[model samples]
Target: MTHATHTPRPTAETWALIRDDYRSGITAPVLAERYGVPERTLRRRAALEGWRRADAPTPSLATPPAWLRPPVSREEALARDPDLAEVDAAEGGDRIGLLFDPDPRHLRLFAFRQASEAAAMDRPVQAVSWMRLAQIVDRCGDRIEADGRPLREVDHLRAAYLRRLGELLPEDMPADDA
Candidate 1:
């Protein structure tokens, strides 16, 4: 006996389902499992619709919870965790860089420790700016530039990540990776 193959036809509802799920920041794998489809199929559908998630903010960022708001200062942040203050103290005016990986339901908050002088110069330290430092580290290693001139800014044990990034990054990294 011979078996006949039939092509699967997609409906408008299918596209809407995919678009809605993606817009809501549902991962392709999660959506595939929910809809009983393969992950590759979901990805293909997303690509076909020109629904690129490269710049879309995760749901957590798009709708942040009250507690996830950015802390105003390093002191306010360290207050919640005394150990952080201790580490800061131990560093003795040197900078510290931290990379956080939060749960899917939450946003990952990156932070950097700056010397009081450095903090005063650039108030309102931003987490995005900190990550930019990481990118610079990855791209240029420990050495960087200052005021359009080359310099070394790595040595996390001694320098603030932002100061390094500011000295290195050509201009400025985007605030929203979203």
Candidate 2:
């Protein structure tokens, strides 16, 4: 005759502690091991109780930055800026140019913003690609703006890149203000 081992269900206080730890960004597996519960059990209980990680961005915070937001439709863009209607008609009414022109400075700024967003979302590869694009645009812009043409300082871009680098590789890069 073999005796089966039995584990007691977690008490209310124990469950509360588990929930708190989970919400505080502790992984379910780690919490399970620490609290003497099965990983699946902890995850299931947290799901049933609608537990949200504290580090997760809220809905408003998750919204893309204004510069990254594209116009929903050509009609909407035209409606907002009636002046663009002429340009739209000239471009066959299909391509409604919203915001930035074909300027290298604008392109660089756009790329930098995209890189920043990718970094914020923990997408290191994408962030790096955008950063590279930004660098290329900046270099091209420099050549285009040769002969003492006035251009905005790129210190902000450098600062942003450093911040993103820190986000991607915390140990290698120093932290800076966003």
Candidate 3:
């Protein structure tokens, strides 16, 4: 008769080394070499323990930092569930406005109900510091309105376009070019 022997589980010392090194931005390859374990084993253990990749930051807790100072402070976070904090945590920092460039032939005004709506649907977009018609134009190429009107730039964009237009347009206006 033959007896089958079971390999001993990793010691607490091994687990501690894994955690400490992981938080300090050590790579799995390095950890594997130091611990004499396979790289895949280290990664699998990290995954099971909810350790995130080195490049990503840990999600915030149920209650945000007091420093957040939400523009519209409700009693609770918008999601209202601590478990969902992971999702919100990924969206750390302030809100942003995303601009979408529809097909060249399409012409739609800014009619989104909420910023989240645009994010929910993956669209060609750019985040703008301020949500203004002119700001959108500055970020994207010039666009004409559906009514065949050339939408003029506003404020900063106006100056930029005027300079660009000057470079493109001739100084002398032809009699028929009026």
List the candidates' TM-scores in order: 0.25, 0.31, 0.28
lDDT of 2 by residue, 1-178 (tens): 9997888999999999999999999988899899999999998887678788898655464676654565357788788899988876755422222131245676687678779967876677889999999999787886765643333448557878989966788575656679
Q: Residue 150 in model 3: shift from native, Å?
A: 70
- Per-residue alpha-carbon lDDT of model 3 for 1-178, expressed as tens digits? 9996664556889888787888688888998878777789888888778786677687767776443434333336554766756655543322222222332222113322223334343321421211233345444534433433333336558878889977887868664654
TM value for model 1: 0.25
Ranking by TM-score: 2, 3, 1
Top model by lDDT, which number?
A: 2
Between candidates 1 and 2, which one is better according to TM-score? 2
Note the Cα lDDT for every prediction shown: 0.55, 0.76, 0.55
Ranking by lDDT: 2, 3, 1
- Ten-residue stretch with the least lDDT total in model 1: 101-110
Structure candidate 3, residue pairs in collision: none
Window of ten residues with lowest summed lDDT in model 3: 104-113
* Best model per TM-score: 2
